[model samples]
Target: MKINFSSKTKILLYFSVALILGFSIINTVSFFYIKSYIDKNLSKDVEIFKRIYMYEDQSKLIPYLKIVDSNQNINQNDIVGKVDGKYIVVDKGKVYTELIHFIISISLWEIFILFIILIIANHLVQITIDKEKELKGILEVFILALTHKIKNFLGIQRVNIEILKINFNEKALMRLEKAYMLMEKDFEILIQALKSLREFRDKREEIDLKTVLEEIIKELESIYPEKSIFIKLSSFKVKADRTDVKNIFFVILENAFKYSEKRIFITDSMEKNIYTIKVLNDISFQEKGSGVGLEIAKFLANKYNWEIFNQSSDDEYIVYIKIPKK
Candidate 1:
């Protein structure tokens, strides 16, 4: 049996490998660079010290002292702390341990800071690449669907135009007009989708959840004036792309408003790090009609790593959206 891994699983595997390789390369580079740096500039007086003073390069100590031999190839201006570490330098036939100590103090700190920065940069770059890949997937699916829709509409429009031109009857004209209206509606939907995508680009900020919901509710109320709606939402601050969050809740709330028989009730609560929203409404139809709006909401939720699902019974429909309080 062939096991088809999910996109998310594949992304995770790639991300893990990238992180491991990135850290391993950084570590290997740091080790070699530090070793080479010490060899060229810091590890020059170890043999001299061991040969002259019988002081082990890895086990020796001193204060602010300087020792000069008659045939000295090492010079010590000043030594701070312990001198047991294998840090030695030879310059102009002068053994300099103090300079080696200072070099270690400075170089190690610099390397550590650079290492941390690289790790952070690597993680951020990986996250950005992964998100872009996901977006590309969404765009590909959308374009394919859009192309199919355009072909279908164009085929129907062409046939209808030919019929009207040949027959010139009331029925043919009505059919052609209906096709035009449907095409216009599709264009409107396309425009809205494009607008949403444009608005959602790189716009991350703190959003007042209740405030945004109220705005969506106002807009939806204008569309469904006859529908009685009630809301009891928490004033939680959520950090996300504001337009994305708006689109998610807008679709769910609008879906509720569009299908309700009499009244719609919306409420929110927070548990742990998850904010849960519930939209309940009396169903006017048993079938719940087409679920395009809910499907869109679910897609947006899944894209952002949130949770959204629905439940329906004989009398009512309920949509639940779980968002993280980040």
Candidate 2:
């Protein structure tokens, strides 16, 4: 079984590993540091007083310091060490032992405190993430509901407009028809905007490259008659969701015409099972558009074996999309 971790989870795991490793090294190094301190300093004391009974009278001055003769048997605190180029028996008791214990205990306490902080931080982060997820679910539901209501209202307006078109004179009807076009376009945009972008694949089938591009071009021709589009599509069928592929191409082509100064070029290339589409146009530099079409295409591209990227300069904009071809 495979488990996929989020980026946040990966970061937290890395931090936790480093935290453990860092403290482990600190404790190890600290133990050795104190080991050498006791070896050098306490061993020298044994060289000064060569017998355990020699320090018995000075017990109040140096507690737990038991320096003894080389042949003397030591208690639990005894250790064999070299002092002044001679062998000695030494018992460095609570003085050095307490220091070692204090150091290790302090490191453990630090580890405990930091681990508690990490737990609290992770708990807070998880809470925030849960809240965000809940808010996103609520927002998606709200937008879906609002868009649906607007779609129904727009459908009614479309029907009433079509019915009343017969009653108006030529001049009034022309104005009404233009207004109708604007309303339909706006509603189409609204529907596209709120449509569940997360659902990219409702159905997958072979979609012809040339036919879909030409159909999308025809729709734009009625809207932007002055713009010229030159298409050079490769002969291939792309195995993908029809609506998704169409929406992506439509957005690319529509943006080309909508923002082009005069000329828009459409071309495609195929290699093995991959098809690449390129849309190139000179920037119009007119009133900027909403670019909701390209946004929709980008959202769809992220979900499939498709790639969409673009480059632009002061005068030209070029976009490329790579898709799987059957």
Candidate 3:
């Protein structure tokens, strides 16, 4: 069987491995430094004591001398003064063991503290990276679905237009014109969909939400000459990147056009530091297709962490979006 990991899982795994490896390397290096420092200092102490006893005053050597007897036992606090040139060398293990234990314990704790700090930093970076990857994945999928739906709808329009072209009588010509108009309207909707998809897929900067909606409304007027689109704006903004927001608006407007039998009512609200845009139209349940529009809108909404609510009654269809103000 084949296994696939989500981007978040991959990031966590990579972070864990890096965190562990980094701490391990640091601990190893710290141990090595301690070992070298201990070895060098021990040798230096032995050399200094040897020189003092052999050439300097042995009477003063008592204070600096830590003697080890032949049984390999050392007395760290013992005072043994010698005359002019005597040596203080014993072979004992007890004093040496105690000194080694003290140094190792202190060095081990230092290494532990450093490793802990590095691990914490790694975890924080991992969390940020995982969040970004998760958002990227969702956006990619949503855009892909949008593209698929646009193409499918466009293809249907093309077939309908071609059928209309083959009929050329006076009465047929009138019906052909209506079919051509529908095909043209579908193309306009595709353009709106593409506009939204491009913004997200290309990672555009922040856009004026009001301006984008106005543009969508302007285009809708031309597309549906038989239907009216009304807008009521109240100074609200979406805390979404430009491209994502454009796609979101495009999807909403497209739904309005698809469902509205006569008129579409659109309005915005900004209250309690939150922005809400509502688009309402009348629709028939029989008008539902493969549900591509709703699906694409939902997919992209999740990508941006936006809340989407849909409500429909026998006489009306409504879409409400709540956008947080950053």
Q: Give each model's whole-structure lDDT.
A: 0.66, 0.69, 0.64
Which lDDT tens digits does candidate 3 get at residues 55-90? 545435433344344345535434233233443543
- Shift in Å, residue 95, candidate 1: 23
lDDT of model 1, residue 165: 79
What local lDDT score does residue 147 receive in model 2, on the 0 to 100 scale? 64
Predictions ranked by lDDT, top down? 2, 1, 3
| lDDT for model 3 | 0.64
TM-score of 3: 0.65
TM-score of 1: 0.48
Consecutive 10-residue window with the lowest summed lDDT within model 2: 193-202
lDDT of 3 at 148: 61
Global fold similarity of model 2 (TM-score): 0.44
Error of 2 at 141 (Å): 13
Q: What is every candidate's alpha-carbon RMSD to the true fold? A: 11.0, 13.1, 6.3
Tens digit of lDDT per residue, candidate 1, span 28-81?
676667656655643334444444445433234422123443344443532311
Query: 19-102 in candidate 2: lDDT tens per residue?
Result: 878878887788789888877876566545554434447456445553455565455446554443444444455656787677
